[model samples]
Target: MPGALPYWRLSGFYFCYFALLGATAPFLALYFDYLEFSPARIGELIAITMLMRCVAPNVWGWLGDYTGRRLAIVRFGAVCTLISFAGIFISKSYAWLALVMALHAFFWHAVLPQFEVITLAHLREQAAKYSQIRLWGSIGFIVAVVGLGQLFEHLSLAAYPLAIVLIMAAICISSFWVPDAQPRHRPEFAGQGRFIEQLKRPQILGFYLSVSLMQLSNGPYYTFLSVHLEALGYARGAIGGFWALGVLAEIVLFMFMAQLLARFSLRRVLLASFLITAVRWVLLGNLADHVVVLIIAQLMHAATFGSFHAASIHFVQRSFGDRQQGQGQALYAALAGVGGALGALYSGYSWSTLGSSWTFTLASVAVLAGAAVIATCLKEERP
Candidate 1:
């Protein structure tokens, strides 16, 4: 199409990637509950899945950058994910489920960072269109969460595997139609730069560390927020609504994000996001009972996730340019992957033993630390 990518051409793939996440994030705990798995067992299963992202994304990134064949790696990863997810359907045991979870996550996580590189490539000078493209994925998430919430209330938990399989199949089919554009390497950004050199840049290191801590803080939300909300007498529909609200806010943020960034420096945006995250978690910890406060906290997803993510990607694109895009994207995924894994594991333990308030309070502290690092290290000048 003229300026917009034909949704028929690209939206389906984004839909598949995010739709799988929607199913897993909101309902995985409930799925574990149905299998009679204990809280700890569920935590461990989810932690292992996050752990796989740490290694898999980097591995896939390396292969893609080295071969200059990003799409091939994505296609392979998707097929592997499908095969592994099938293993979950065949077995009901915790051991089998854990293996399935880890295996599928390894492959599933590999696809996204590469897809990000692909999206950036396609965006060219019109990166502002990212939200319009990405919003469809948010729509997919809303559809999965709302539709499946009602479905699960009536249907048995046995439907989980079938739902997952069908969504994954959609992803695979969509992958076939995704346009793969190769980024032209820019020597200025590439020459004499080892990965370690890139890592050693003060702004780069600071940005990575700051985002790592912020994501670490998010561990509790990704792992236990749904369970916590459910415990507070929020029905599945309400919880789904709450989750949908956050994404809706995120969609709004994405829509205005280009203008926001043009008006604000990246460091300023990152700084604000970190501070808002600190407040959002603290509120989520102490004020979830107050509907008004909860809605406000949910709205902060715009700053905490959508703004921060756009700023990070913008920083990467500005800093690394075309030549190092793959590696830059991989490094972001690596830090986030590792941080998220540890955060999920720790949050699982803390949520069960220390309780939600203390867990989220600690999460708030983590974000504050990230904010401090960014304030000190991320700079106005690109290296």
Candidate 2:
């Protein structure tokens, strides 16, 4: 809506940032497996990376909010992430890798929540346009997943760390190009009380609990979906295509999200996403051997991640005051991290013993529980 909006600059940062995710989320576990690490070890390493999100965002968020320097924090975090992640090139030992994951992720996780605050500040009154900017992240993800899949087909999995480092460098560079914007304080929301007090509200607690559960459900998919498909006799390139397909669907969802939100309440959208995600996990668990079933499951990522994420961002923006925006987004990231860590830990331990089918079924159960929370606690509200 604003003529001076730095749309491409904002979108570029998201592109580079999520491009790194595209490489890591689908392939990181496979890289660990290439090192001959056990399933539990791979899970532990991934969990270590995720666990940092629980702390990193909140710390950086506070500093950004207190200092009024959100962009500076984003830039600093990006550089630190790139520097720390380079440690992966030094050692392949489990201890070394775990330390590397934790250090890099601590800084890496710090970037997004603060950047989210920045993005929304830039959008100002045209908040509905948020999805248009965010869709580039999905495109970036698609590019990385498909490109790296083909690259890994020709190159060694050892190339994974290098790919991530280059992408981090891009994220660091992109951060500088986007100018910062401050959230406009709204007097009407001032009476909403302290941030901690708001957090205690049933709806807020329920929303966060549901966020954790949704991510917890995603743990298996992110941690092992590539490995699982590889075991099912699919080629690495095809596996990448499957991941890309899901993001492609996510991109499509983002394109229409402004209109979608206009017609439906956030509660209805979120509840539907949770329910569809439940069925998706079930299909992936039981019938992944069927290409058609696998395709359908992957497509559900539109709901599982795309819609859920867009809705969650809108919710945070609406719920918090100008001063609390960074923290609101930080807490959202932190809770998702908590759920993700639990999911990764449990799925890793269960993957070999309980079998893939059962592991995903467990994921399905977690999502259904999230759905129940949404159905009962979140009220119907237009975004």
Candidate lDDT values, in order: 0.83, 0.94
Candidate closest to the true structure, highest lDDT:
2
The CA lDDT at 104 in model 1 is: 93
TM-score for candidate 2, please give it. 0.99
Clash pairs, candidate 1, are: none
Residue range 6-48, candidate 2, lDDT tens digits: 9999999999999999999999999999999999999999999
- How many clashes (backbone atoms < 3 Å, residues ≥3 apart in a chain or on different chains) does model 2 have? 0
Which residue pairs clash in candidate 2? Answer: none
Off by over 4 Å in 2: none
Listed in order, each prediction's TM-score against the native is: 0.95, 0.99
